[model samples]
Target: MPYLNITEVESGVTSLAAAFPATDLIELPEPTFEGRTCHALRIGTHRLEPKPAVVLIGGAHAREWGSCEILVNLAADLLHAHAGGTGLAYGGTSFTSAQVRAIMEKLDVVVFPLVNPDGRHYSQTVDPMWRRNRNPAQSGGNPAAVGVDLNRNYDHLFDYRTAFHPSAPVQVSDNPANPDQVYQGPEPFSEPEPRNVRWLLDHFVRTRWFVDVHSYTQKMLYVWGDDHNQSVDPAKNFRNPLFDGKRGLKDGLLYAEFIEKGDADDSAVLAERFCEALKGVRGKKYSPEPGFDLYPTCGTSDDYTYARHIVSGQEEEKILAFTVEWGMDFHPPWAEMEKIVLDVDAGLVQFCLTALA
Candidate 1:
């Protein structure tokens, strides 16, 4: 199956859903600007009420075709394993059928295999470098300049004031009209793509973990993408105390404190486990670090999901969010895609196992 286009992705998802009747294939509330349906393949149910849920999202950036394939294949593997009543082997570890069923029974696994359908279609058919959704409204009605980096369109820590770093030689754009890289929309959750993602996270109250899959970097990234310091001590790192009152600097400080003293250690441990499983296949290495370690980014889905728990003050239900960067380039060669998908699938399986463990 060709993984470069949205049609193939949709077909694969449909086939999987047909094969696994238990899987719920849900279309997002709204379609992309190009009228392409964005589907979320949900495995398992919420009837158990508040089960630990893990959401795996891919194709956020249109050009990263490999990410979508990895997610689809992973979902298929799980469904096939359940259907055949067979165990799954990964990272030299085998999961028994009972264990697999336990995971399915206890966790609500939601996979948005292709988050940006319009962009995927555009990249596969038109430009292979398209990185955003085809939302012409954001481009002053100019079709050529229509695209919002969905990765930077999430709601949490979305204020451009905190995210925008004017001093950095390379920075995300505040102006949508500029039409350079990293054009965050006029406001947070401004685009339908991100709104769909937010809708999923909000509707699924049991989502305790999230993984936003992307490609070419081969890294496992944790939250707080706006800050580069891996070990940012909240006490000394928070410079803006009263910049915009309680909802502004105060909230930011509290977020930083949670990062430093509460979530960082556990998040790093989960990332390390994921990287270890990934390396087990073909000896591929993946660096495990904070998201900003690669570069400062804001409005990212992973960070937003992580912040959801922090902001809610739900310590017990804190969502462990991550961004898994696959392969070494945005568009890796077709011949190399199998190994890439297998490696990521193994890592993701291990991640789910860890969550259930």
Candidate 2:
């Protein structure tokens, strides 16, 4: 079970759509810095109708091989089960044919398995630990500044110095030299990888759920990445300029991102459900926690998706966004990676089923 290369993964998306009439191949408008185009598969019964969509994206870091594989497999399993009218079972976890059909008929399961093809190519061929996109325009002739951390290039609090406390452990760097390996980029959405994700969400319009899949931690994380979540103080939120310098502080009262009590509860419940399903598929223990529990991050995709309705001033549902860090390493052994794929595919099936409730 060797990992699929970037070409194979991209071709896999096209193959899924070609094999299953229910799946449509979505061509992203922007090409990568290396002039490589990205593709996404939208699977469902109704392609034109407005419906709830569960967007599963991966390969942002490039080195995390399992993320892309898990998503591709999930899409294949759903399409296969729906088309054949057969049940899908992964180890101890099983979904009936009816459940699979409901998923296709009721929800749009959009899988963007590879976000940074150029970075993935570099990681596989040259650097096994490469973690960012290969865009050297801002490198300033410094070899180390060859890439921008796609994860930190989103627009949510891109200005970390103004948005976070001086002592906050925010992981972002503005320097194009990018020595920290977590550069925030010259501006938000500066690179095409993250812009592709933003475009996908905007194009879909009805996407109510989003999961930016990553690795090296067996955790299911929910929104409010910059600070602890609080529903009590609406004015002390990320949009409020008054709390700019006080944000991301661990001191409870100092600052906390505001999320409505119901939204917070929904995020927690769904995350727990996702973890529970993954555990059922081979008894892998996956914990549900806040995104900040990993660290205080700025300009992350999950936080940006969750903040869309609040910040965009557009008519959109408050998306319940998540980040599922699968397995225990960036690149796990192929034998172990096979099992991890099944574990997460099962979890995603349960997530789609739960979304209908």
Candidate 3:
């Protein structure tokens, strides 16, 4: 499958609503730097009422075109199954018509297939590796200095003092410039793209699951990307109560501890199920791990969504968030595109089924 341009993706989403009258194609109020419209496709039954909801977002990093395809195709498959009164079989698990309809009635699946339209257009038309939004404001209105890494522009754990240099505190640039690939803008939610995402999360009360789709790493990552510890309070001291005095450091370090144990465990199990479904299709393996385990990144969408409930003292309402990295590389060749889509689509379907269970 050839990578879809911004216009094609938008049209594809709109066409879904046209093809299936039950589906809704909503245009987000915020526009990109290039004046491209941001759209979200809401599909499933009981959309008007509150229900268990899943939000699937892609193209946050414009060059990861595969993510967009997987989401759009998934939406299409679901709509097809629902409208035709047919079932779907994936990863050896059968989703009966009854089960599918039950999920639709009880779950709302909203997909923002393409989040950064301007950056995606730039990547597809101008540069094949453009990883940020085409926001020239970061570069002081310099056209060449365009882009703000949308992934890093979220509100959770935003380190404006340190900027892009995650490891070192060494001052590189006085201003928030795209000097490197991971420029985190002047402040959190600085870019409109991610702010729109935040808006969706805020308004959608039933959003229980959130998956930020990206390409190339072949992993499913869960929250707390800012640091090793999962605790919302950075200064909170932690000591392993179970640690015996004889084994190593007596003073328990406040590192990599999960603030919410039950939530973490449940999220881990769901991710494992997703990986299992992926392997069921052609035996492709996708590792399930924490986001910080891969690398320490601040202000990621996954962390922002997951941590919001915890920070707000609403642990029961915490959204189970994950970043799904599909395929083996950012730009998987056309030869592998279809299979990649199928594999990911299976995993996603399994994820939705798990929600119902």
- Which candidate leads the pack in lDDT? 2
CA lDDT of 211 in candidate 3? 95
RMSD (Cα, Å) of candidate 1?
3.9
**What's the TM for model 2?**
0.98
Off by over 4 Å in 3: 90-94, 141-144, 160-180, 229-254
**Clashing residue pairs in candidate 3, if any?**
none
Measured against the true structure, the TM-scores of the candidates, in listed sequence, are 0.88, 0.98, 0.88
Scored by Cα lDDT, where does model 3 land?
0.77
Scored against the true structure, residue 338 in model 2 reaches a CA lDDT of 97
Q: Alpha carbon lDDT of residue 247, candidate 3?
A: 17
The lDDT of each candidate is: 0.77, 0.91, 0.77
Badly placed stretches (over 4 Å) of model 2 are none
Better of 1 and 2 by TM-score: 2
Error of 1 at 259 (Å): 1.0
lDDT of 1 by residue, 169-250 (tens): 3236666655555888888888899889888888787788899999878999987676543355444232344322222122
Off by over 4 Å in 1: 45-49, 90-94, 141-144, 162-165, 177-180, 228-262
Q: What shift in Å separates residue 193 of candidate 2 from its native position after superposition? A: 0.9
